[model samples]
Target: MIWVAIAISVCLGAAGQIFMKIAMRDAGPFPGLIGVVDIARYFWGAILSWPMLAAIVSYGISYVVWLGVLSRADLTLARPMVSLGYIMVILYGFYAGERMGWERVLGIVLIMIGLFLVVRSGARV
Candidate 1:
């Protein structure tokens, strides 16, 4: 189904973000444009890191998958559905030892609600 491909692409994107976050733990703030030396510290090491590499590949594949999706679906309908990735990444954080409070829980629930409506409505909008 088209929805299945959409879900795969969304999951790939969310997983990429999660992998990048894990790879950057303790790396501190991103270096400024003027901080060339600081940038160097994060650059090569990150490019060589397995998690970062995985994230890059994941994102690359997700983009490819999205191109296929665009050919078969309405962008307006499919774009909103992509918000499912936000919910997935937030839940990943919660389960990965990050502290999730009530507000975030509510926000996730609201995203689910909106996604549900979007699916039910099809491409009518």
Candidate 2:
């Protein structure tokens, strides 16, 4: 039951990140630190955009869901599950525009191995 909750949080977290990236693409790079409002306004517009709006709502729900998971699970277990988000980020990056190479693939494999060990070890606790 805890594991299931953990999985949901990780997946939701990953989806949140992907949605953020989609939002950022339209939002553009962060503004120079002339005024805080400058950055805030840019983000405000992004938040209003359709893709970003959806992303915001999704992440909002995900965050609430994640809090519930955290209440039931240990930090050790919950943190490891977030590695799943990194995997999702990599895949989304490639799909969005980033180049995929052998090194990236290797890194993904390593992350998966480490995450697997973390989860396997958690099962014992």
* Model number with the top lDDT: 1
Residue-by-residue lDDT tens digits, candidate 2, 1-125: 76777677677777867777777887888887879889889978888888776766767877887788778777776777778878888998888789999999999999999988887784542
Give the alpha carbon lDDT tens digit for every residue of 46-96 in model 1: 767888889999999999999998999888789988899999999888889
Regions of candidate 2 where Cα sits further than 4 Å from its true position:
29-41, 122-125
Predictions in order: lDDT: 0.87, 0.79
Window of ten residues with lowest summed lDDT in model 1: 25-34
Each model's total of backbone clashes = 0, 0
Candidate 2 TM-score, C-alpha based: 0.78
Q: Give the range where candidate 2 is weakest over 10 consecutive residues by summed lDDT.
A: 116-125
TM-scores of the candidates are 0.87, 0.78
* Per-prediction CA RMSD (Å): 2.5, 2.6
**Candidate 1 residue runs with Cα over 4 Å from true position:** 26-35
